[model samples]
Target chain A: MTRRRFCATLALCGLAPGAIATALASEGHELRLGLTPVFLDDQSIFLEAWRTYLTARLQRPVVFVQRGSYREIVDLLNQGQLDAAWLCGFPFVRHERRLRLLAVPLFQGRPLYRSYLIVPAGDTHTKSLLDLRGKVFAYSDPDSNSGFLYTQFALAKIRERSEVFFARTFYTWSHRKVVEAVAVELAQGGAVDGYVWETLQRSHPQLAARTRVVEQSPEFGFPPFVARSTLPAGDFKALQDVLVAMRNDREGKKLLGQLNLDGFTPGERKLYDGIASMAEKVANRP
Target chain B: MKHFMRDLSLRYKIPLRVLVLASITAILVTASILFRVYDETRNDLLRHAESMGRLLANTLVGPITHDDVWRAYEIINSPFQGGSLDQTQIAETILLLDTRGQVFVSTQPTQYPMLSEPGRLDPEYAAIVDLATDRNDVKPSVVDPSDSSRLFVTIPVISEGARLGTLVMSYPKSLFMPRFVDIAQRAALMTLLALAVLLPIAWYWGHRMAKPLVRLAGCMDQIGPSVPENLHCDLSESHDEIGRAGTAFKRMLKELKEKEQLEQEIMASERLAAVGRLSAGIAHEINNPLGGMLNAINTFKRHGPDDPRTLKTLALLERGLTQIKDTVAALLVETKVEIHPLSRRDIEDTRTLVTAEAAEKRLELIWENDITEDLPLPSTLVRQILLNLLLNAIRAADKRVECQVYRDSRSFTLVVKNDGTHIEDEDMAYLFEPFSRLSRNGHGLGLWVTYQMARQLNGGIVVESEPGETRFSVALPLQEEA
Candidate 1:
């Protein structure tokens, strides 16, 4: 694949609906990963701390790559080269064969984050998925639970129009990006994780001022870092054990502190299966 | 290439048209037939392969496994492998697949170079992966990406109520493609050969038709201004429409030539008659110059130009020049030309001139007018006829001149008479004859020219001149053809 397409594929790995760990548990060794876009020490400081910690503990170098589109990421994952990824819910439902999750992120003592459907501050749209019709809506990524899966479930409850109702729809690949899409009017409204919104309110009040919450959905599991099926069985076991025990250890807590998490939890594989089902229900939205 | 284009451009246009039309029609017909044949043949081949594939896959129904699919593929491809069958004969293919969605074998293995790799993935494997993983509802289906010109068939290998996987079959479709290329090349070569054969026949037909027309045009151009005309191309020599037309044309040309020769004779006689009348008028004027010059030269023998003789000689030279000028004026008047921008006043002017001339001749003229307001005759001819008659009457009149101009819808008449003369019936018949003078110091051509001028305008004149009264009248018919 071309370098540009490789980058796009790497980016799409996050948009795919799955935690990389579940896929990695069944995969062979090496744990090659297609990560989301890079960190700028802003909304992603926690990701860096976790990666640094995970690599140190696992005693293997962690590789990060950027991809352009969610479909390309899933393509790489299906190729068996991409052992793990942190993806949004779309690819998980789209390519469940190559992907699954491990542990989801937590902040302020909660294992979940509410998805905020935000629009411009003076916008007339009210609470409901149907109200956003003929308006541009954004998703942070196809894989993020709050960004896509839970919002997709909300849409299923109200109206399933992921394909058509909106005048336009897009992926911004991060909760902060989804909020920016709505704030800057690139999209009329978007689904963002509540945690990212709160942080933006604290750090960039101008961005927070640009948008207002039009609707809120029930909480969904936070973004998860997964391993691939290609990873050795022993390595997959080791990685999951370490992630579950991070809150109990002093160094892990300190590392977790940098990412603003209360603790990590032992996630069940079946916990995100409902996300896939939610996608199916919403796929035929009229 | 430049010369080719120039030669094409220089092609004789009439025949070029015929050749182009014929070649284009032939080529379009041939090409259309060839394309139709190619499409039908290719479709037939593909259809056969598809049915064969279905039958082969049916053979695998009890055994839709990897090994069975490979066996099926091998069995199907085996027929075309040896020299017994021509690969170039519209190559086409069919495929059989096992349940795992793998193309276990192909009819032509070398066609898909990538498939040679062991454990290699399908180029569209991503799409297959998505189809297999994402939707539980969409069953085994067939997709034809005709843009890529490949046909893919995915069959479900369902046995004993369990989904074993997908049986994927891909047809490399380029088999029929190369056949079309060969057919097109062969078709083009044949079309070229046909056009080459047909062009000369078109030219031959075109030249045969146009040859007579070209010859006629050449003959017309070569028959210059003064040639005698006749139907020279013999009608009796050939039995054809052209021969009849040539006979008719020659007769028409002969008639026209006679009319033209008659007109010329009249013009020459009129010129001679004018010369005679003009010579008399000139002599009187020239006599005055001679008389003055003789008197001046006698004076010059006694004195010089600085003396009394000089003024007299100058006066005589001026008189001679004036006589020459008067003769020139009359000559200009005689050669009748159409007065274009013809107007009502010009005819009136001629009528008035006749009356005035008769009055000057000291004849008690009796004049009458019965002419239309707008006479449909050129004023130059009108004036000439009136002047010629007046002049003749002045010469013949012993005491009186009688003049008449009258017209009805279809004719015009001019008559002049002198009561000083009368003639016998025999003499009256030749009264308008050239040089037949009846009186002393008289030019007889006046009546003759008047007679000829009338005829030129498709009319004639009669006269009665005798001792007591000589009458000359000219009648002109107004024909619509004029």
Candidate 2:
């Protein structure tokens, strides 16, 4: 519904886009995706819409299982319960070894977005993630990139220099929720991916009415669509080609627009390899 | 033991039943109030405690989430105290813990076991912990050791797959503590107020009741044959039992006083009547002898010149004659006197009349009845009544002068009083009866006839008597009716 939540939900799915390749290659295979947002029993019938879309393309039944957060997506992918997911850069970095990228989302013509630490328009204390120590910090999702992990990565950078981040951290669950948290003063400041924050400010003024961007992190790849690493190599390449050429076909372009992604690129694992390496470096350094 | 016996033996006293009822009622009412108040107060205390705990936990949530761990204690103190939390009056401990088992804050940290040490989780605590992890939706709840109905709430801080800490609070269930306690206190106070008001009313009523009995005793003390007048004691007009009894008792005494007065009046009238009848006849009878003595003395005086023997004989005769006259005079004085009756005259009135009452007692003659016939229309009843009294009187005259009867129109009045000391009021009432006498000289018949004749003629009588004189007057009704 909201860009921030869209990103979080993308991250909530416990698999990567490449997993579709494996499902396509294997006969009698069941296509599965782990969605991290909780599924209430009321959504059982409504989820059939997603099943229909996936089944028409794969010529098989596509199943969706809900998890509470992207951490669960990563856990599920590692456990092989998920074949693919639409995931944020943070958890992708953590479990990239177990996932494969199929597509990267594009906003304003680019696949890069920065994390912004936002404060209420009148707040005077915090200017950056590093300055948030002993002050309230709001994160959209613990597994979110711009909402949490990137800001956390900024903390990771400080920790590299032997410093701690904010004195306290709280979860807002989604990008929209994070901005809402700052607006409502539930937290002093919030961190969200830059594109999602701008998009939310334009769409939901009440959520952004009391907030302003105080700081932003270095740009990172936008949340990417990925499959689990266990998907077959040939099937992975076919899925990649199909996604990349999507903008050229009318139906494919509509699908790409529906998913809010620019045409897919001939993705090399190298772009995400560095994020994984950085996370490892941060985890190891601490 | 004395006090116990006093309380127990109160049964014999008039107010024992009232006392027992009052004591039992006071204790029963007070005890019931005390018990109810105690229970309600306890419950209210518990409810207050839980709310206080909630406020502290909610306020502290901000500081914990912000990681400003130290400010947590300040946050709690202000809210718990500022709000209506009275549970601080009781001993309690508040604790806050972080995910790493680090103690963040506590109100009375000293009361708790060392926070740094990992305390052994009882089965329940361990279960709650496990529940928080699997499902973040499960809120941390409260525990109450004093009452089973405790309440609590918990909030978990989760960020990026890491657990920050848990906010746990516990308090008792007090539904009616303060309100019910107030009620009990009020009941006790009300009972006391009722007693304060009621005791005086009861005493006043009791005093009213006792007053009549006390008056009865006082009146009894004044009693004698001629009792002094009784003092009036006021009592309630209420128809309550005591008032009714008092009214009735006063009425009885009044009746008795009237009866005594009536009896006295009747006896006095009878004695005066006796004296009346006696004088009229005695005055007439004594005149004859008195005339004879005068004639004989005159004759002797005329014939006396040179006869010595004759003179001597004459002197002897004169002396003898003078003695007889003195005897008659004395009889008249002694015969008539009025009577006075006392409240104690019951025994006196019963004694029969006798004669010569004054002479036997050595009394002097002070007055004599001088009337010969007291009625305009003379009756044999009056004549006989007179003779009976004179004969009786002659025997008792002793050294008194002779009596004479006198008469007049409009008043057939008669009186004969002896100078000899009159009989006491108690004895005079009996003097006119059949065999009664002031002394032992005669039987009682003389005054009985006088009494009967006076009454038959419908005459009224009156008596006046004291130490030196006794006088009686009988007024014959012969003063024709108009």
Candidate 3:
């Protein structure tokens, strides 16, 4: 028994301590925030600055859990591993029962953005989603409102299925990649977030110059910061307060500039009503 | 090659050799420098790619573990962004291979799809997978495949003693070509500049150095077994080796000239001695009989001739016999002679002796005497020399003869000139030798006798003949008898 206990203690010393520390960190002192590649450009620097800001204001260590697609972040947030996440409108409306809207990012002073239909700069005839029929298309993500749901909702209004409307389609999993696909002519057309395309035009003008915007969807609620429904009320309120008050702080405003955002607001649930209706329209299409 | 070089002229040989040696060294040095620069650039490019691979590998471990292809792509694509427009990206494509040897992510995702086998992507990557998947030691390796134009660097991504993935970065081999070409161009320009500066100096120095040697060689080529009297070497005055050699050659030439002069003098003396011996022998053999004949002629003139014809014949015999004795006496060169100072009258006497001969040809005779005092010379020898020259002049004259006598402090001089036809060049060589018949009148012994008389008096005679004038000049120096 003595030797067995010693071996068990050795095993605990070898491996269990790190696992225990990680578990305790997520539950007690650390806030694990999920980030999907939606409108984030220069991910590491922006994530680092946001983490520093949140850690200082909320008085807790902030850990940003970044993922390639919205599905991963949504899954983590629903599983309660992530306390909160910045997610697209479509995913938030679909998972509304498990997530709560913490704050809506203000882009150009409004908690609203639109989907942009883009084609190669030489494609002058493509002006609407109907004109992109039978062409290869790239979507930023399957669960994004601006990149996928809005285009599907528009197609559904004309009684069309996306798989049948476009000859081929693929997910680039990032809004910047959707713009890159259309810019390099890898895709004849693409659906991307309007904010990402506009930001890219400002930062990477040469890359954006190769692409042309054919259509802009009606304004929908911007992708918002949300918390898990199971998160502690104190932590949720603290995160929402920190995000909403970012415009009032100098360092927070600088970070918001880096993120190409005006500020954040505790927007109403009706702000995402347009995305909810689009998701419903796409899903209910026979 | 040695024989060929030996045959080349110094003018071309020196510069050619210097240019050849300099060109060879320049080519070798330039080639070596270019090679070194090429090697260094290639190594630097490869080292840069390797370090990039290592950094990407470290950064991609988290993204690869989480299956975040976007983050991995951004990490690999970072190097391609924000550089100058002219610069090409060093890493052409970067791939992240899972522990199962499948490409989990790639910078060129359309080309190398995710979850594809590494071998399916590229045959070279098949070998790279094995090197990268070495579990014991996951060291970074830079691979330059012989069959590809790309250089590959593989860094293994590890997390806590576990091999997470392999990061493979490929770089085009032509990335360093621009740098190498720049180095080569600079090296080539420097070599050409060096040659441009060095070649003309070599040519000018070669030309300057070879000039004197060429002159010396020309002087040497004119030499034979016998040296010439007026050989001149037009070499520059220098104290270098070739100049010293020229000096030695000139000294040798002088010695040879002196030796030749000595040899000619010895031969002339020997010939004179032989002639003296022969003349003495002839004089001994004929003087007694010639004396008896002359006595008989005188007796016939005084005692046997009473008829007019007989008297005329006796006078003719006496004159003929006296001429024979005089001719024999001329042949016998006298070694011992009574010395007497030459007076003005002796020279005047010579002019008088040649006046009748001059009249026979109807030649005008001009005589000018400038002597005021007696000259300390043998008067008989001086008078004989003067008379012989004047007679020869008269005989050769076409129109007139001129005799001039002068005395300076050191010597008494006589000049006789006549308007005459020029002597032939072939006849001039032996004009003073015995038995050289160069004229239509009188025995050729007259000038030979005059030459002998001048030598006996330690005087000299010269003859000049041209188209219109012929002159004979004699100079007799005063010497006190020992």
Model 3 stretches astray by more than 4 angstroms: A1-33, A37-65, A105-111, A130-136, A153-172, A180-188, A199-210, A232-274, A280-286, B1-9, B32-76, B82-181, B188-216, B223-227, B230-482
In TM-score terms, candidate 1 sits at 0.32
Task: Please write out the lDDT profile of model 3 over residues A77-120, one tens digit for every residue.
Answer: 98889999989988999999999999999999999998999998
- Which candidate has the top score in DockQ? 3
Which wins on lDDT, candidate 2 or candidate 3? 3
lDDT per residue for candidate 2 within A1-286, as digits (tens), equals: 2244345444434343466546556754766665543111123333454455555655555666555467767787788778776678778777767787777756667777677889877677666655656555667676776776556566666663322344445664556656655664546677776766666666566667678888877767767768888877765665556556667777666655544456666555566654666566666765
DockQ, each predicted model: 0.01, 0.02, 0.06
TM-scores for all predictions: 0.32, 0.45, 0.51
Interface root-mean-square deviation of model 2 in angstroms is 12.1
- Give candidate 3's error at residue B197 in angstroms: 7.0
Q: TM-score for model 3?
A: 0.51
**Model 3, position B115: C-alpha lDDT score:** 62
Give all candidates' CA lDDT scores.
Answer: 0.59, 0.56, 0.80
Per-residue alpha-carbon lDDT of model 1 for A182-238, expressed as tens digits? 664656678877777876786688988888987777655555556555666776677
Q: After superposition, how far is residue B96 of candidate 1 from its true place, in Å?
A: 6.0
